[model samples]
Target: MAGRLVLDGGTVVTMDGVRTEYASGHVVVENGRIAAVGPGPAPAVDGAQVVDVRGCVVTPGLVNTHHHLYQWVTRGLAVDATLFEWLTTLYPVWGCIDEETVGAAATAGLGWLARTGCTTTMDHHYVFPADGGDVLGAEVEAARVVGLRFMLTRGSMDLGRSAGGLPPDHVVEGIDQILGATSEAVDRFHDPSADSMLRVGVAPCSPFSVTTQLLTEAASLARDKGVRLHTHLAETLDEDTFCRERFGCGPVDYMASLGWLGDDVWFGHGVHLDDSAIALMAATGTGVAHCPSSNARLGAGIARLRDLKDAGVPVGLGVDGAASNEASSLLEEARHALLFARARGGPQALTVRDALEVATIGGARVLGWDEQIGSLEVGKQGDVAVWRVDTLAHVDIVDRVAALVLGDRPPLELLLVAGEPVVERDRLVRVDEQQVTDASREAGRRLLVKAGVAG
Candidate 1:
């Protein structure tokens, strides 16, 4: 458990600056760090666990910057509504959530992520029903069963409809309770080391769902604990209007006044940000989690990703929440990002390599984990995934990256985290697949019944 392993005879595609690909390459993993990466005739094959991946495409495991893993239970319930309508349609069902339901749903969602080649993911969970018993701990336990690198955000929504916010009163918490729970989560669950697997972030839900004071204090607490902060901002025109009316300032200016414009923060669904906001983000080294599929699903506008990247902003790809996107597949999200970007700003706005980089290195960088686990390079973590390129989904493709992004779903062979296999041949290894599916379906049934919509 504490030695090196050599994955030789594979097509290692490192999403480095050049998107380098090495045929018949060997990746040496020692003490969890990639010792070297090159062709065969590598050092130390004497006692290492040699995985001969001759025909597999070995690359860094996909990184997901945003998710609401508990939304797995509400996937089909809010199918064709906009952001506001969708939230209103699903809030009643979500109000019935308990810790047990969230645990089961999150486990299934994270397992799906692993099956699609994701090793690291950040969950943005904000719903806190009045009756839910310690939902945060339940999601955390689910991550352990799912067996992936996790960024668990202690997400809070303090402003309810009584205060002119979107969420119902029963789903929101007190400001003191929110901040107190966040600090407790940081002290208990947050890992601040270089080799940590479970890192915690302070997230104040969104501008509409939380007060300005909550954002300021959340940022302060995150900085004091040296953890990352995340939330939603400027997702749609309605959100922009809410910010202007409620805060008496635009989203960017409000965040700036709260000292939230910094490198350790990343906002989700940044589709409605203006040029000046982009400039401020670039100057402050702040990051954005671009959710292309969720935007299209909810009819939200396209994010100016190429513009953001051009302005030197850190842009990462996310699937958002499964309730909006229908599923949490990193490869599917990458494909959507490429096609969606081309649809907005012409064909060259985003390339296959750029899309791939967003799912891998860019996401890691956004979560501030690039140094430990992003690309298959020397001194990086051994988080590798093997997707089968021999199938019809990848047939007759000259460009390997195109074979992945442009075609149908490629058959996955294996996915690893820290050199340990979590997915093998397109199946999850850490969970009982059928059990999780049954649990999620049952939870959905209960929710539907509680909402008086079940047949």
Candidate 2:
């Protein structure tokens, strides 16, 4: 059911185990898997589509490990607020989202990520309005229409303002309702095949927004169904204080006591984790999705990424909520990771290659997809991103690999997922880009009016 194609003559950055770089290379794709990769034209095949990428830089397609796809509609609204203030201000507004709003936001967000060279994205959608019917389904359909691999987290929040959580009551659901709906959605959507285009995970939004009972039950359910677990942890001192005050232990200890430290679990924006917490993560093989932009934007402190990596913790990059980062560009997110790491730990903190690794292989590992989509290996999925730097910004750059992270990134020249071209020449081919833009704007306007944030 898959086609044959060849991307010939480019600077291939194969993020394999050895981190191979090919100055002038060709990658052959057959039946949705990488057939061969070497430093020349591929062997001739019958009816194969050959694409010339002579002056381009071809790398494994970028992976985004964590995001709140529905927050695109609320960008620029809570710019100056800290994490708590921002969530408090936006919770009431998010309470107004319906299926259409969620769908439009997911479509726009996925399109933006694709435009920036992402082939796989994991969305954490937790804000379920009381009457928001099938919000998870809406996002799944949007991902289908956008033509990228989708990993949707059936995120839930059970603690509300009345119960001392930040989100408004209307946006949070009862424990029974959340669990039932989450299991139902997982049964209806999760695909466990190696080449599955869709996969579903269970995520209880965060420690502050959920109850201990809910967390335990969600973890139990995820283990029962053989799915993954995700949540936000240790993003701020306030969260640490909340954990100490509420649970009489640190966030890591709280999670460990609940049996949440393992390879099948990952936490987002792990900014405030201490040395002990980092050690725990490394010991249990738990992963971290480092959202530098969102953390900096919300005044959350820098994550100890260098320390975590040195301790053998799986660290990945995330764009987080568009409302926090304001851009869903995985390349730019990589750049930010580099910049923030240097700002925090000095010039030797993170290199361009390190940042790029977090965006590619690191992300794949975080999402438990390392074997299939992270590298351009002979038997891996045919997901590649091509960027041309022949323009003025890259004219005199001797090290093109550094240019991808240090300089202005050129728009993606081409993107392929499983031998299927979804973006070519910086345009999304599966759907009208302008139409998705317009629909998202309309949805934002309607949400603004409903939340009474409109001018």
Candidate 3:
């Protein structure tokens, strides 16, 4: 089981620089890294585990650039609320969450993501109760149970409603506590090695929910520790107005003034950015995690994905939070990205392959993990997702990539991280799916009761 893994006789869609495709190919994984990927018969090796993926399409495992895994239990809440209203309604409920709820929600959310073919994911969990013990650690435990490569953001929100922020005071942490815990998290959990299964990031919620001081300090700390920075930026017009009135500048200008525009930073839901802001992002190599489904669900305008890509900005896809998206399937999120782009422009706006790229390599780039993941090339991590093309949803598929985007969700036959199977035969291999669901449901009920919400 620790030796080479051969995926034989599948259509390999390598999201390499040239966007190569092999009608019939073999992929070899050894020691958690891709050893070979080429056409025709695979080289036989003694004691290698060969998985016959005939009649399937194999692609680099999807990477989810942004998520709020702790919000998994809050799906369908504030269904009719906009961005601000939704946060206002749910802050109290999220504040009621403790270590147990965080673990359950993360387990369920990460399981859902893994089932949907995501290998690497980033979670922007900014909500933490004043007494919530080891919230980030609980999420890491869940990721270990799900066996997904996780980049857990040590997200902090120091400003509260009393201080003109969206969250309540009890949910926001002190700036000192935030910085100290973030430093500890980076030192304890973040692994800079190429094959690390877990990493940490510093995210200070957003400009509206955090102080300028917290943002600057968090960025500095992240840089000092050699980690990455993330937050929500230009997600809505209200945020733009907040920046204009509060900071006397636009979101992009304020960010740059604080040394936030850099290759090590990525922002979520960049829907309202203008031409100059896009140019800044392109120049600084700052990436965007486009949550098209969540944006549409909350009535936020569609992001200018086409414009961002053409500007040389690294663009990726995210399912966002379960509360906003009401779903956590990265593969389905790709379809939403394609449709949203076409709706923004014409039918030629975002191609199917473009959507796939955003879900795969582009996401890896957004997380600054492109060198280790995102493609089926040799020396990259052996993370792959296998979809059955012979399924009923893809019966008449002429173009495999287009079919993947436009067709119904194909059965995810297998998903592997570091050459180890996490999901196989349409089932999660590491954790009991039913147990995760039950625990999450129970914890959600308790949280709603504690928050005084009748469910």
Candidate 4:
């Protein structure tokens, strides 16, 4: 139970049903939920902590729909390779991760995301090494240390190189092992409450990395457990070719045949979808986690973001893994999403507000959490971000939202999840940043040495 808090005199952008914007407003929070939101000063309340955010932009804390937090230790590897080439080169190294390395990497990754104004993030972790002891538990503990809302999708890869999959045989698990572990993980971590700090989902790696039986059974398991489903789909030309050769159809059609499209499902990297695929997704209420930076980094094609938006598809922003997108900043994802959309579809492809929406409400929708945390409403949880727009990097911009989405990344004044401060004055509240960085560097060295890639 958090006490009362008041954020006064900031430009409030409520990404609600009406897209309301308050020029100067006050938001009062009580008992971990929004108590009031309106223009001008807040009503005086005794013993309330007041934060003067006169030059800041107050909005819902950013939601990251997709990520690979364990890849934090593998940043800057295979920099010039395509997706398949990159995966082949890194799988051997990733096969050496343990609970210690994963914990350190997740700490660094979650800390960085909090600094970049992300309040909630979902991690798709599929690489389960044979010797890796409780990797999922390690990351969940890391999230607790960083004090951010986390969703862990127990991702599985059952297809190996022997079976024509992308990953090597050493990194793949058996179907029974994968399903049992996924069920256990959900029972241990998932919280269905409106103000839950942690949740769990079921995710198979991708179309090319898993067998049809695994996909079908995983979907069935997720549905039976009442959890969401996620997987990579249509990410590259190579993926399309592989699916066409192996499954006798495109990636979208193959997944559709296995009953993997619905409001309870979201796919990462829907970059190679055609018009018919887009219509199918829209009709089925499936969502997309658009990772523009990773796609550009790996030379994957640009996703049809404008078309997805126009067709009423749920879409969200993602920074993806640090291995491909080394920056891994959710705020920068908004800028990249805007620039990439325009580069592909001209200047009118996306607006600044549109990018912000995808980062906030749009992402919440993808995670099936919009009713609680996506907007600055009276009854929603108090998950908010205060970006310092009065700084030198953003001071010149007239529109605060544009400054946030188009200009350079501004310092985060504050970030709150469930009314508790996770970041304050550009620093993490619960953990030491320098310590996290040092641990991550050590973890990276240890993993590379274990894999015989470094001495």
Candidate 5:
């Protein structure tokens, strides 16, 4: 059985239908579901674990649609290179990953995300040393231990440099082995219910790392199991050239050939999608995870986010791989979405509302969980994050919604996942922060040594 709680009297910003925002509002939680939310109190708060967030901005816990949390140990090594070069610079180090390194980095990353007011995150773990033990299970346990909603993508790479792919051969797997392990993990871990805290996605890394047969088979297997599909698509001009030259089609058409366009499908980066790709995604109700910070870091062009959103494609936010983005705060990453889109398309291209929306509900939609965890409403999961208005935009308090967009961040105050507070006063409660930090630092050192990048 779950516990009950009540968050009383805060500025509730429900990015539900119509992008509603209310000042001095009350939200109640019972058994991990938001029992009631409105301007005033209900009968539910009588004996609940009452938390008064008087000066806080209570909003739906932000969602992160894509990340490589273990890549935290690979940061600062892949700089000043395009996507292919960057992958070359880092894959060897990643090929050395073990359960301990993956678990520590993932746990630390999730802890940081929770303290940054993100309660849910989707990790796109594409590294498979084949020798690395239970990479998926390691990350799942890390997320659970860190107390965040976990969508672990059972990702694979079946083609390598020897076979004209990006990753080295040591990191790629046999197609049969990949599919078997993926199917087994889905059966063993994926929960289909609306109330399930954990779900699994089937991802085949990217076009440059896997064969077409593997992509098609992965998509077919994903459809057979009724799970979501994810992959990296069109993040760089080099990738665009690769698609046009190799496949005689763009990324979207190639995906369509694999039966990979639907509401259950989400492609990361999506920086190089053309008008046709945008139309196909919108028509098929496909989702995209926009990696704004990673695009900026890798010198990949900014994604046409406003165009995609305006075209009716479901858009969400992603931190991408830490090796590329190097930063993990999605709320802070939301600011990058605003800045980058504006840098390319001018200020009106993507509004702050749209940026924040992509981080929360839009991300939920991409992950196929909008109905359960995206908004603050009755019968939805009570995953809430309280962002203090006093951070740097005190004057913008007149406009709370604008403050989230334009104001500087106050420290994250309380982060609740299913009505359980995992971060309070910006401190993690699930694991000793010091222990995780020390473990991660050691792992980072080891990752560099494994690559011979450092002694």
Candidate 6:
């Protein structure tokens, strides 16, 4: 077991049930769990490694509920295109990616997420080229190297353009192959322990890219394995149109018919949900991962975040894929969530604390891991993010949460996952960032070249 560590003299925001906060406090961590947290200095421990975070604001480490880590290598392409156009333009390039490229991309993406104060992240990787040897294994290894709590949804797409889907035929897989591989991924990777660092979910890409059989069967498979289910829904108007024309209903109702709405299920985007959809999601305990920046990037309408929250629907923040939202910082997503919510429903829509909650406990709830993570409560995992708010960009902001959500992104002084330091002093502790960046760049070039899109 690792030795005990104490973070002393920081403003502690314990996002517990009652939303506790301490102006000047300390947190004691032992055996990979939070032992204590309260006002003033922590009780003295004989052999504890104490970190003085006097000028910092310590909060629960941010949780990113949705992302496509493989897209790190595919950024800056189809920038001006719509969602459908973008996918069409890049599907071929993504199909050329093998295990090596995926590993590089995942490593780079996870390292960057660490530097940005994320201790837990979920990756939705749907593209699996036939020759892409163990792409899932490669990303799992990347998460291990980066030392973050990871939930990898083995996403699949079996509906090709031949079946009126968005992806090319070559990128789509057979139903039998997808279900078999998804089950294998869950069996091989998912850990159901209270303190598990890794878990796998079953995700059948989206309604537009997957058939009814895959979605229904995937939900059943996830339930059988006692794991979670995830997929894209209501992400764009085009998807709404597709669902209406093809499935004869909106995305939410169609998913409901397949028995996909439950506490164990969470959908990405959800930007086009209406009053009825929101109500149904709330009633079913289904959650939504709100990707504010990505929605704006794709010119997709902003999600009814205020409505969802008011309706008691669990809403979490997500940075989405780097291919759409190039700035993949989870911290920035909190800012965007606040701004977008206010834009849609006036200044009273979302407060700074609300934004922070969405990035932390709300995400934890969406991922169904709030019992173990997402807050600084005693006995929870010691996943904490210490932001240096004493800097020039935030020193004047009296409210720590406001400083974090409203001011410029503060430098992350430290990021801890399960009492282990994943990032310290504003840099990654587990991997070399520069090397990861270079490898990711090379992977991008190799993929484009393989697709004959680059020299």
Write down the TM-score of every candidate.
0.96, 0.98, 0.99, 0.99, 0.97, 0.99
> C-alpha displacement of 333 in model 2, angstroms?
1.0
Report the lDDT tens digits of candidate 5 across residue range 1-455. Answer: 14777777788988888877778888888888899888854456556777778778899999999899889888888588887898888888888998888988898888888877788899888787756787778888998898888898988998888887788898999999999989998998898887888999999999888999999999999999999999999988888777788899888898898898999999999999889889999999999999888888888888998899899999989888888877677887888889888889996987878888998999999999999998998899989988777654564567776777667766667888988888888899878999999999998898778778899
lDDT of 4: 0.94
| lDDT tens digits, residue span 1-455, model 3 | 45788999988999999999998999999988899999997999667999899888999999999899989998889899889999999998998889999999999999999999999999998887778888889999999989999998999898998999888898899999899989999988998887799999999999989999999999999999999999999999999999999999999999999999999999999999999999999999999999999999998899999999999999999999999987788999999999989998999999999999999999999999999999999999999999988877896898888778889888888999999888998899999888988999998889888999965
Summarize candidate 6's per-residue lDDT along 1-455 as a digit string, tens digits: 26699999999999999999999999999999999999998899889999999989999999999999999998999999999999999999898989999999999999999988999999999999988999999999999999999999999999999989999999999999999999999999999899999999998999989999999999999999999999999999999999999989999999999999999999999999999999999999999999999999989989999899999999898999999989999999999999989988999999999999999999999999999999999999999999999999999998988999998989999999999999988989889888888899899999889999899
> Deviation in angstroms for 417 in model 1?
0.7
CA lDDT, candidate 3, residue 123: 93
Report residue 265 deviation for candidate 6 (angstroms). Answer: 0.5
* Local lDDT at 82 for model 3: 89
lDDT tens per residue, model 1, 270-389: 898899999999999999999999999999889999998899889888988899988678899889998988999999999998898888999999999988888998877778888778
Query: Mind sharing the TM-score for model 1?
Result: 0.96
Measure candidate 2: CA RMSD. 1.2
Error of 6 at 347 (Å): 1.0
- Poorly placed runs, candidate 3 (over 4 Å): none
Prediction 5 global C-alpha lDDT: 0.86
Position 200, candidate 5: lDDT: 93
lDDT of 2 at 293: 83
Those runs of model 2 whose alpha carbons end farther than 4 Å from true positions after fitting are none
Candidate 6: residue 306 Cα off by (Å): 0.8
lDDT of each: 0.86, 0.91, 0.92, 0.94, 0.86, 0.94
Please report, as a residue range, the 10-residue window in candidate 3 with the lowest summed lDDT: 125-134
**Backbone clashes in model 4, listed as residue pairs:** none
Q: Which has the higher TM-score value, candidate number 1 or candidate number 3?
A: 3
Better of 4 and 5 by TM-score: 4
Candidate 1 scores a C-alpha RMSD against the true structure in Å of 1.6
Candidates 1 and 2 compared: the better one by lDDT is 2
